[model samples]
Target: MPSDCTHEPTPATQGPKLLEERTIGGILVHFVAIPTGVAGAGIVYLLATNEFTKRNARNALDWHLTVLALTVVTFGSLFTYAEFTGQGVTDVATLPSPVSTIASVVIPTLLTLWFLVTFWTFFVGLIAMGKATFGTAWRYPLSPALVDRYGSELDFPSKWPFVIFVYVVLLPLVIWGVFFGSTDGAAFFLSAFGLLGLIMLLTPLTAVAMYLHGERDQSRNTDWKPHVAAFVGTPILIAAAGYVISRVFTESMYPPGDAMYVFLAAFWVSSIVYLVRWWMTASN
Candidate 1:
């Protein structure tokens, strides 16, 4: 029995391998960004559209939709550009180049900052709503200014502010990543982070749906049912749209690298749907 032999792996070593496998499986779902972006955008788009179309709702939907559209265009263009020309400033012309260098830089940067502010405003509004719902005596931080402009009743006691916040925080970050970052950045930061943000925003909507469903059992209110349906339906539609866009653009339009734009467009449409739904529901 003199020969030195290798021992078999212990259960302790095998445990880590098993855990790693599970983690990898979880991460795999995050690899597809276009679908996630589409879903998130869809949710916002439906919400905004609902608000804008509602007779009694405030006029905030118009602003929300405009910002959302601009953000998508900016990000989509950047993705398309990167797919074709590769990342970064390829041609550095001083002025009057085909590329509007100043506009490109300024627009993205300003949009991103504006989104951050919007997110902050929404966050505050959500907190205010929580206080109001719980019967606390909390006034909105900037209520006086908002009330002076849009009136207090229009701005208060609703989820629109928080919805806007989600848009502001998410869209700008996505645009920044696509326009400014590398391939890995696009995949991980822009896509993955964007999905995560969407999930975060969806959490509240899901809770609201659940609350509404429960309330329906006690009371006769059926309003929450549409929201729940919208919540479930929008994501599926966005995913389908993404797949369709991928197929159509890859087949009929530009070459392999240019297919990203199609995905972006599909996602944009999905987002519009989401905003519209929200706008309709939230209006008083």
Candidate 2:
């Protein structure tokens, strides 16, 4: 007879480990580090190693930015304008009739709006924090989906930094070129055409590459039709609608001077549509 023997399972035979990095980073950004503000949230996004964590960080960042924008529009800009113009209501009773009317009416209204916006920011931030803690997918209401619009293409680890670089550096350059480049015609033409060409070339290449690699490795089972429609249809639809409006209504109402605004609006709308569709497909 042999003595009783014991055996234990090794780490190699253990089941897959739970992923908590993204969840933790998200909690830190939105909940644990709320007082640290947007800078802290951005740091979380940059330091996040996985897509889930990055998405959470992205949500936090977008929420914070939205809050900042609301603050600026409601309170900061109004106060600054009043101060610079010397129209700020220091002593309402001393102000002239027109100024007193504005101070009495508009100032209180703006202050109320600011307070509402501030309260909204705090409430939504808390909600986002709760969602992140549970490892759920979260989107900030009314915040522009800047990351979701572009981040889906960033599946590859190596391309992450380059994408960040493009947003940080190249985007501002392109904006400057578009706005100011017309002053120097030759340089503008070359720079604009060159930059556009580079973008066009890279976009298709990146799409094809992602398709091939993702199909093989991850296989999202995405339908190409909705994406194709969104890409090819949005601009056409907007352009057609605008043309109709210009012709049927007064062309003076939506003049050529505002074409840039129309273009930007159309671009963002189309991008959001495409990203939403892509996310739905990927999630399925």
Best by TM-score: 2
In candidate 1, stretches whose alpha carbon ends up further than 4 angstroms from where it belongs are: 1-57, 88-183, 217-284
Per-residue lDDT for 1-284 in model 1, tens only? 77698788776533333332232212221121123332333333333333222211111223333345556666666654443444433332343435656556765786686577456545543453344333332433432322135434544433443443455345545655666655552354456546454444444344343333333322345352334454445555665666666667656454332334333434344445555654575574
lDDT of each: 0.42, 0.55
Off by over 4 Å in 2: 1-22, 84-107, 148-284
Q: How well does candidate 1 score on lDDT at residue 165?
A: 40
lDDT of 2 by residue, 58-82 (tens): 8877777666566556655455445
Residue 121 in candidate 1 has what lDDT?
43
Residue 192, candidate 1: alpha-carbon lDDT: 54
For all candidates, the clash counts are 27, 0
Residue 196 in candidate 1, Cα distance off native in Å: 4.2
Best by lDDT: 2
